[model samples]
Target: MRIAHATAATAAAALLTLLGTAPPATATTRPAGPPATTARPPAPIAWGSCPDSTADTRQQCATLAVPLDHADPTGPQLDLAVSRITAARPDQRRGALLIVPGGPGNPGLNGPTNAVRRLPRSVLDRYDLIGFDPRGVGRSSPVDCGLAHDDLSMTTLLPWPAPDGSVTGNLAAARRIADACTRNGGPVLRSISTRNEARDMDRIRQALGERRISAWGVSYGTYAGAVYATMYPDRTDRIVLDSNDDPDPSRVERGWLAAYATGAEDRFPDFAAWAAAPAAGDQRLADTPQQVRDLFLRLAARLDTAPLPWPGANPARLDGNALRAAMLDTLYDDARFPRLARLMLAADGRAELPPAATPPDAAMQNTVAASAATMCNDVRWPRSADGYARAVAADRTAHPLTAGMPVNVMPCAFWPTDPAEPPTRITPDGPSNILMVQNLRDPATPYAGALRLRAALGDRARLVSVDSGGHDAYAAHGNACGDRLVTRFLVDGRRPAHDTLCPAEH
Candidate 1:
């Protein structure tokens, strides 16, 4: 039941790692064509030392001006923060390899630096690793809805239902959130859709003076990269989409939300086994995986009626939905398993409650607003309350862990505007230069969804499915086999002749 926005900052593999925008006038379809050209082509980037926080003098930063609304190129423009780590061996340089980070709201300014350290020297020597914050994000022109602190909580933002499964509160919250963005998001917010992001990427390519740019896109970024490949086939060189989403033009983000039910189900076994191990110590939940599952179910059901007082938490209590959301988040990475274990320990009266984790106020407001704008603006949601109620009830019965949140209401249901354009339909007509790497049990972008994207691309793409349990695939949770395959594809322009599956890393 964790919202997509909460998973935004989860892919900093190095840290373990540790760990938007505006509104616009009348919505219009994004323009389709070659990268923009002018009497004088976009000026070449004048790179300089990165911010002090980046602490990597080898990385350089620059800014590019892109139209706020691609459909209205003459309208106001926003500056996109861009960064790059030049190829180590210029003589072997192949081209630029752009890193497209996840979260329609997430920034990619530091991605190149991180990627350079993880990628093989062969690839690093051949490509100038590039990264940029998309419009209305990070160092880009950001937009915030100014939502109240409580409303910024993960539990509230995700639309968790009442104890009795009543969605009355969810409906009201969705409306309130949507109204806030409408009132404060301005024209830039309305411009934040997947199609526009792709267009902005093309603008970046033009500014970088690359006729054909290679890319490495992850999670939500996979979808954006696919759209870019679909819309501008000839302009792309090597393309890698890791942990992909289903490119169902009709459902898009709504489909991603619904997939969490199955995704969580697919991934929980790994956690149950981990939690039940002898090494788990006092944090262990049960003697066996089945027992662990039963324990969690019973605990959640009990909390529905009697939530525990949880000081420092937004709602100041540990309710069933909050527990469910925490479980979802913990399932994303095995490294996060202790978070749920500790929570369960506290709930069972075996330990004290851990301090709740809260993101910075400004960061939360900006990311939530941007996530809502992109999800809602990309496609229309079913506005009928009855329809949602039926879907949620059915989903809750089928997938108890998610507790109907997957099909529940979101701010998109109350969005004020229709999608500005139809989603880009992924097709096999594009160049067969795309390589996809995905984990079998990813909690955010599930393997089943990745299959859909693989199928959508037909022979144009090959998938290297890793038998793993986590969100990210390559160089993160993936086995060496999967990593080797991806490295070969990116570094040497070599790809397997067919879709292949690599055994899980032990």
Candidate 2:
């Protein structure tokens, strides 16, 4: 699987335990409009054969010119790379179904190609699948912070404090990263906010000549899709938000960051149970779930003081924070269970260190910068290091598995620029056209957070909860029942009469 942006992983944890009650309602008023752009409507996209590296021959590629800053659309322009696969049965075409990728930084250029293989044939036959790389990402006008190689490491990007829970080093790292972005990232980096992404989506719709468009938005894209639906209610058709995020306007990305503590807590049990099962063979950590948890905790604590050298891994060591971060990443999918299991085995002297997987340096630089730009630009983080220190200490005490990384200081704490506009509040006033599919035990976007999103949408949405663990529910790590609900909704405009739950997949 593709590695998510480093900040994406750090931002996954929550500060508080999973609360049964939903977050209280916030203001319903929409934020002020962006500065008017040039009156010129973009010309229709000129489709061409995709690049040689593109795996799917059916997928055609195109590009659209959008304003670097929507507030000043006439000032400077940026190119957004887009891709599409026409409906298999054009006679029955419903409209374009845009795939909004998860990371604020992930490239969506292959979304259409990837979806065609997973979605039901009926849905594929009915809608043109569309995808795009948002501004300042991938084939779009990319942004780079020009960070040093070490700065690109996930451990550094996540602000993992010292084993003793000190933020001294974390604070300095945050400052260094923030400084690097300010120095190397240009105006394009500043333009990479969620609001701009939503605007870019609208621009894509206009370019496609579609009055309304459908969407399948996952992870952070769910938040962007929610903002788009709220801002342009009439322009949305069927909307599917998989692995939803809480749309708390007051907290926004910070809320996402804080969710990791609860998310890890909720998900760890599944991993524990799997690791202890007899069927796990040589990978079994213990005979019982509780034992597995204890073993993991003990091993992590030991690593805190005496990290083992790992030749191929970033930072070249297996320390407490690295182990914790690895656990967080592996929890996203059951398929990755062996990764954590092997790490545990190595820690216990039962196995050797596995080959480390790393992304290209250029890719990491772009993703990190884009992720930081969107998150830091979307909202203002607390400027006081002391505040983050306190929160991290509290989080570490409450959720030891995450080691306070969720609430710890990040580059955003020292971001040079404030959000251009307030975060958009998701209200229930939009058209009742959204269907959310989520896994009950998702590590990144947990069920508790998904509940907050469900509550926020109110009458505007229906939810299909899958009794499973992992992220990106519909047709991905979700059971047939949940997948059927989402596919039915997208293909036939049918949703459950009310919120529904699917039994766990056997």
Candidate 3:
């Protein structure tokens, strides 16, 4: 769910949506460590005023310098922009609770401000909410690949194949991006990876002077959290991993991307049902769910053959791949159903097309660069173009909704650097303080994947699966039961004795 999803209308507004707006990545299985550093007592932060964009007046900001490479701590340093809103009831304060954002590239400095609005007063009063931008992201020593603007688009970055399921263009793009990142992205970009992010987190913990830190990591953050908890097991107080990625160490990022195929299949029924409802009126695609599915498939295939001119869009056309991309993005949330419905209507010649949407070129460049680094560096990907073409061809037939993009080639196939360390394997070796919240039908990180993470954690974690269809399950989705379970766990340190399921809201 951490994978950023942008609509044609609001893609330019911001990089982060609800849980997050970028693709997700899984954690590794080996103990690649800079050696746990719980004994390093660091200096106190020099808190200062936050940016003008900060909405919460209580939020304070600061910077913590971490090594560009953890192995050599005294090497060049990178400043992480950190933010915090101290507990409202200092008397009731227990410890700090970090709000981990979803993307490997998503900025976390604004997370505390956003959490202040969503978190309950009881939880807010009991812990100081902390947030920070991971290395190579935002104000934390940002890195860019200086990619051509065309390569920055979600459609391209996501690796959607051609109408014929040919990966020829995708392979070319992978080489181009990889070469550019190596040419323009300096050491910082090369240093970006899931394990490194986990190291930076421990550095943040040391700087905070906390013996143990509690965290609520969502989407891509869940993998980061899993790695951190594994690396510094004893230093974790309370952990909540939401919308988890599959921790298939053998596959890592490849597994995460391939998950979209299953996730789309799991979640599409919800969209079909919604689109077929009588309330849909003019926007309704069909009278039944099956009919809606048929209609969408046919429409997309037709668009493949004859794309309509879309002046402001990246490719300046409403091609079948664009429709498919929008479908994947809209499937993340039910609230976005109408956007897809409207687009379908326009594509069907029943309504006018909406304006094109895309995130700022510079912002996407930074995000794509960091995201690609994290995935490519986490674990090696298959490098054969013919191998990828074969996989794409098979996936296209197996999962038409995704059109083989999930298994398509990416810049990682041509990455310039190898992973500095093995992906941290999530084991049952951590404390039993971790609690996970997941939606049964998450389009980004599916419930099946969450189960994998839960199994990996074993007795160290508990899961509260909510009967919902969306990306994030905790505070964003309106499931009071799931919310109460997570809130109680965070506020009082009480969790279900066993895995529990929260049924859908009536």
The sequence of per-residue lDDT tens digits that candidate 3 reaches over residues 1-506 is 26443343223212221100112244334346655433444468888989746448999999888888776676688888898999999999989998877766777898898898889999999999999988888888888888777876667877889888899998888788888877887888878878888888887788888999999998888999998899889899999999999998888778888888999999999999999999887778888999988888898999999999987778889999889888888888888898889988899998999887656687677777677778877887877889999999999999989999889888888775556567777899967999999999988888899999999999999999999998878888789999999999999899999999999995
lDDT of 1 by residue, 55-77 (tens): 46788898888888665576688
Q: Which ten residues in a row have the lowest lDDT in candidate 3?
A: 13-22
> Which ranges in model 1 have alpha carbons more than 4 Å from their true place?
1-40
Evaluate model 2: give its lDDT.
Answer: 0.81
Candidate 3 global lDDT: 0.81
If candidate 3 were superposed on the true structure by all CA atoms, what would the RMSD be? 3.9
With a 3 Å backbone cut-off (N, CA, C), the pairs that clash in candidate 2 are 12-260, 13-258, 13-259, 13-260, 14-258, 14-259, 14-260, 14-261, 15-258
Give a tens-digit lDDT track for model 2, residues 51-110. 747548899998899988676667689999999999999999999999998776777898
lDDT measured at residue 78 in model 1 versus the true structure, 0 to 100:
85
Query: Which 10-residue span in candidate 1 carries the lowest summed lDDT?
Result: 12-21
Give the runs in model 3 whose Cα sits over 4 Å from its true position: 4-31, 36-40
